[model samples]
Target: MCISNPNSISDQTDLVAMKARLWALLRKEEHEWLQKSRLKWFKEGDINMKFFHLTASSRAKRNQISKLKEIPVKRLSVGSRRLLERLFSEEEVWNMSCRLCLIEDSSFNNSFISLIPKIDEAVSPEDYRPLSLVGSLNKIVSRVMARRMASCLKEVVGENQFAFIVGKQIVDCVLIANEVIDDLSKKKKKL
Candidate 1:
């Protein structure tokens, strides 16, 4: 009817309004269909076959452990009686340290490298911090060595070395340097 009356502006406006209403109703119906599809029918089987397949394949890939390297297990020569000894002697500590250094067994030195993200969404290599998860035996040995060397640490290391010392901090050195700089720059220096 609007096509027949081409010059009627009122008719053209009414036609446009009707078309808009139809389009709105069509969109509403499509949204309802999408919601209904997601609720009940989607549980039985997905309407979007491509999307379902993609999700399934991605999940499978994520779950699958690919190219896992074989780690060979080796038995230690040390007896269980000596290994489980509660008392620590100088000889035992020395022996353990020497054995750890010379041992070809990967189990003693094996470590898992875990990447911890520095930011919420890590993009590059620099965004992650690599943390090594070492074996319990290795940690025990390291702790024992550290404890043994802690007494001699102050004697071996100088007073100027503020890092890795139990009683000292690097911030102390920074504060001292700042004070020295301030004193040196003064008109009447007392440094």
Candidate 2:
């Protein structure tokens, strides 16, 4: 059992105690008594912690988000009523083409809001941070849509962009910028 996760309660103890326990188990000569126990057929042996760590469990952590960094927010919650009224009344803007916007699952939005701290515990529906509870069907659909859209979006996007574009890294972007600056400086010096 301890072979699976060494950091478990039993494995975290001193080595001396474990060795003594193993030694006692080994010294025992009786066999009939083992038949009554749950692990009757199990063979005990030396544990290799390194071997166990090679594969990880697929389970998510118990209601915990690891290593959350501050995420930036844009636009205030609501604009002035006068501004909204003016926009609504504008004939030029209204006559132009219209596009629809969408809101993803509540869970998806709550996942972000929950990361931020609040002065009081969540009591009302608004206070509660939601977890994504979308069905498996929706998850599959989302994945397919993402794959299909990736190629289409790629053609229009610049090579330098990394934000929200799957697998791109800020570190790579910064490194490229540094290299360009260095090369430009070298050329300027030569001139």
Candidate 3:
């Protein structure tokens, strides 16, 4: 049946009637599919709670950073130093304070704090990653330059090597590669 009641946009009864009819058709199709095949929809069929839980866990584990290369935050503040005084030895405090000092130094231009997900069951120290943040001013300037240069870039960049070029897709490279392979196959037969 045609699924339109133009007046239903303003009329509640007509809208409800239309929705009931649509639901009836969908349920009818679902019953037919259930009868026709053994396969059931994932959410509506055989529930594998343990398998889904494990798959979700594996995906989360794979995305974690094994180690960090940068040592940007060196030290703890006096308050932090006091707090960590018992937890860390004297030597540890010195190392932490130096990094904290570096983080505070405005003279060290264009550095910002980076925070990312870390692996902990609950919110704790082990649950976050640190990265070097870039300056906002530099980001704005780079974006402006990219926008202005896009038109000029289209003229100079080759028909291939379309990675960063505007209005081109990597799919184009795949298509061109297929054509080259086909030509090579035909040429080999001729020779």
TM-scores for every candidate against the unseen true structure? 0.36, 0.27, 0.29
- Give all candidate RMSDs, comma-separated: 20.1, 21.9, 19.1
Q: What is the TM-score of candidate 1?
A: 0.36
Q: How much lDDT does each candidate structure score?
A: 0.74, 0.51, 0.63
Question: What order do candidates take by TM-score, descending?
Answer: 1, 3, 2
> In model 3, which regions exceed 4 Å deviation?
1-110, 115-130, 182-191
Of 2 and 3, the candidate ranking higher by TM-score = 3
Tens digits of per-residue lDDT for model 3, 15-104? 788899999999999999887665543653349777667867899899988898985433434554344334434564445445444444
Per-residue lDDT tens digits of candidate 2, residues 58-148? 2334445777888653332233323333323344322221211223454432222233324387566766555555543344445444544
> Which candidate tops TM-score?
1
Ten consecutive residues with minimal summed lDDT in candidate 1?
73-82
- The candidates, ranked best first by lDDT, are 1, 3, 2
Judged by whole-model lDDT over C-alpha atoms, candidate 2 comes out at: 0.51
